[model samples]
Target: MELLQSADLYRRAADRIPGGVHSNTRARAPHPIYFERADGAFLYDADGNRYLDFVLGNGAIILGHGHPKVQAAVQAVLSQGLTTGSETRLGVEAAERLLQQVPTAEMVRFANSGTEAVMHALELARSATGRTRVAKAEGAYHGWDSAMYVSAWPDLAKAGSADAPAPVLTHQGADAEISRRTLVLPFNDVAATRRLIEEHAQELAAVVVEPVMMDIGYIEATREYIDELRALTSRYGIVFIFDELLTGFRVAPGGAQEYYGVTPDLSTFGKAIANGYPVAAVAGRREFMEQARPGGPCAWVGTFNAHAVSMAAMCATLQTFEGGGVWRTLQERMSYLEERFAQRAAERGVQVTLRGRGGNFHWYFTDADVRDYRSAATSSAERYRKFAENAAARGIWLAAGTLSHHSLTIQHEEDHLDAFVGCL
Candidate 1:
């Protein structure tokens, strides 16, 4: 597939924009493929080449690009106007729908992005517990905020021990004090996590985890591990936070909590919640969430918190999920694609393991069962990059990087899967 127009645009963009792309992830090795339009499961590039999109806006497009329901809702909201800076009926309805869907969401507050939701959640956690330190699993990305931006993808040589990982800063100028207050733990290791929690129980304000670690390719915590963490945090009076920004509303209606039968003290949700709308939320027990303004210690205020258009989009997105069989169809499609990809890899004598559940998955170019960040870090980055580039050349758009997970949507059909496998 030729991307001459995309190349020309990228060159012009580089002269003005810092990296030739708004997001660093969109800048591929050679040049990014610029999409003119997207519909269903396909992206039409500036050069007029149609490619199957497995990236799906990094797992945000659950119902797929431009779903009729979401579009109609957004259009209706647009007719009314945008960003009133006051509470709207649509916002209340959206909150009610969220409370009905998520098991842990007794109260909800909206934010503009997942990063903001996570920051608010952490602040609430600290205020509620009156503690200074926060604990997070290595290779788990809560957000790019200073408090949680440590050890997301630390170099193995400097990441300390497998059981107790060191807090390595992910970016320059990350707050040294915040990094000092953050504790890094290994995912899916029950005993190690328990020990770390106990050791830092007094100072630890919260324990944040991605139910499925998307940064490390959707590696999920074992059932026993998740259960034990829940129990331990409860016993120690630490705020247990599930960062479901990637997993929520995608794995199930109530997200990984419902799917795994483990409810957290608090949860942060985004990505697929609004099916591509720029909205995120922090939900938890009323006692904890009430701390967000009007009545409590934590200050959670955003001008665009529950923008009318996003609220309408969210309500419509939830309506689609409520219509039944949505998740079932997505699961079946994902399973079929996984099986076909594995078969093709085996036939080609390639050593790779596909990990994850429901509509999300990762292809690691290794045979090992990836359970934790340490184990997952060993996958071949160069080989995965080359594979993504080659697949893109053949009209299959995988996630740009090795650590990222590719996702399927309700828009993805058998033909897209066949085209992907044919490329393989």
Candidate 2:
């Protein structure tokens, strides 16, 4: 197969950077695309090719790329200085604003990335609970850190039984002793979760979960399931953390906690919060969050937390969403796009499964419904690879996976959705 100039750039990048990318998750066999820039819903490649950007910075661009409001905010901050290291006026304003927006949050702490935020949250949980064990869903990914990186992407054969999946270490030289502290459980199984939590309650510090499983094709928790988790965690006095890095601003202004009506003790926000800038935060009840500091036992220190530019970007992004009626617009566009995609797939005799909500959807080829990471893993990567290649050729961009995520913007119109349908 012939490769695009963008793909060639990725090959060159791989030779220098490990896997030709900073993150292994973005790398694939044919290589990734090298984008020159982006504006609105379009990405300009190094080859001067413009493609409709469904990836949307991997669901970070909720306000779309180069939003005028966000740009102006960043420019204003830049006119002064970009590095304030959590002491800037902008950082203060952003943190206060975030606390106002997040219902479960009485206090807020910032970090440079989702991974950093999650890592800190875990520490705070452990300190608050005085426990060492952390529990996560078998396939859910929190970050690259040793504690939470236990079973992100597991080999099917070595992953053990579906009922109680084995936690496989992804990193080299990772201490087996540390990995043993994390317990993996099947997602969406209330009974299984109850069993595990009950079994490990005394030793468990926290149970981290994504309200909407974003990377695994946006499978949502049934209200009953979430309620069960909350009750069980409350009973056990374990911190229930909602990793809303992908679902926070994208799902709703209040994030999944408000949408699901199940409030986690601690929540992490990222991706859409800064509309592509590298900013993340951990917010929760005042009592729990106070554990991370001079006021509490946990030492959650990061020099780069809430840098001036990122803080300005976050405040600006949230302000834009306040006026943009983002959730309503996303609902309308997603409903239309999903309907068209499903209709076209039906006509084409494609055996693909459509999952997720609003702008964030996953296209999968699976015989059974995907509820957790294991089921999501069995998705048809081969077909998605072909679909991505075809979509890229047709001037549409999508990630190659049995699941893909999207960001909604005004630039993505009916015509674009129709063209995507036509391609299918």
Candidate 3:
């Protein structure tokens, strides 16, 4: 696949834009592939290279790129005009749908991005509990906000002990006081988490966690860990926030809370909610979410909180999942891909471990059990990076850098699975 045109565009973009990309994740080692257009399960580059897109807009496009339903919804909004700066009937309808679908959603508020949703959730938690500290899993990424960004991708040297990890800030300008208020705990270590939570219970407002740790290659939380955390938070009067940005609609109709049978006090959702449209939400118990009201302690206001186009797309995406068969298909496809790839790796004498559930999985070129961030970090990322680059060269677009999660969409078929596994 020729990337000459993409390369030229990258050079031009670098002259004006930092690192030639808006998001740091888009900055490939050599150069990023500039896409001209996207269709169902495929991305067409500026150089006219047609590649099967596993990135799927970083797992945002659940129904796949340019789905007719989502496109029609967006078109309808366009024809009606992009209404913002105020609430619309469309937004109300979308919230009602979310409340109906999400198991923990009694009251809902919209945001333009997952980060903002998480921020709002944190603020509500702090307000409700009158606490100053928050705790999150060491490798779990809620968002890039200063309060939750610490220890997301901490360097091993500075990460401190596994049981009591230090909060290592990712960015330079992140507030030190916010980092100080944030406590880092190991994922899947129930005892350690309990001890930490108990130690800081008086000051801890919320304990935020991802049901499946996405930033650490989709390492799932054990049933015991999630259950204990839920019980402990309730017992201690601390808010339990589930960061479901990556797992919301992809895992189940109601998300991780439904999948795991444990509901959180508050939940932040995005990514698959709108099927690539920029929309996110904070939903939870009514009493907690009420903190965001005008007279409430926490302030929640946004100019484009529920942009009509995004609301339409979200409603359309929810409609597609009404039959409950969408998740089943995605699970079957992901399992098939996992099996085929494992077989291919065995044939080539390559050691690989596939971990995760639903439509998302990670390829770690090691047999070690990836239970936590440290174990996942120790895996052979160099080998996986090389594999991803080779796959991209051969028309499969896996996101570059780290052992990232690969996902399938409703549009993926057996042929795409065969092709992907065959590439390995």
Whole-structure CA lDDT of model 1: 0.86
Q: Write the per-residue lDDT of candidate 2 for residues 89-164, one digit (tens) a residue.
A: 8888899888877867888999888889988999998899889888888778788668788887677788787777
Compute the lDDT for candidate 2.
0.81
Question: Model 1 clash tally?
Answer: 0
Error of 1 at 162 (Å): 0.7
Q: Which stretches of model 3 miss by more than 4 angstroms?
A: none
lDDT of 3 by residue, 191-309 (tens): 99899999989889999999988766778888999999999999999999999999887777788999899989999998888999999999999999999889878998888889998
Sorted on lDDT, best first, the list reads 3, 1, 2
Positional deviation of residue 4's Cα in model 2 after best superposition, in angstroms: 7.5
Error of 2 at 34 (Å): 2.2
Model 2 steric clash pairs: 14-20
Top-TM-score structure, candidate number: 3
Q: Clashing residue pairs in candidate 3, if any?
A: none
Query: What root-mean-square deviation over C-alphas does model 1 reach?
Result: 1.4
Compared to the true structure, candidate 2 yields what TM-score? 0.94
Candidates in order have lDDT scores of 0.86, 0.81, 0.86
Stretches off by above 4 angstroms in model 2 are 1-15, 28-31
Task: Please give the range of 10 consecutive residues that has the lowest summed lDDT in model 1.
Answer: 415-424
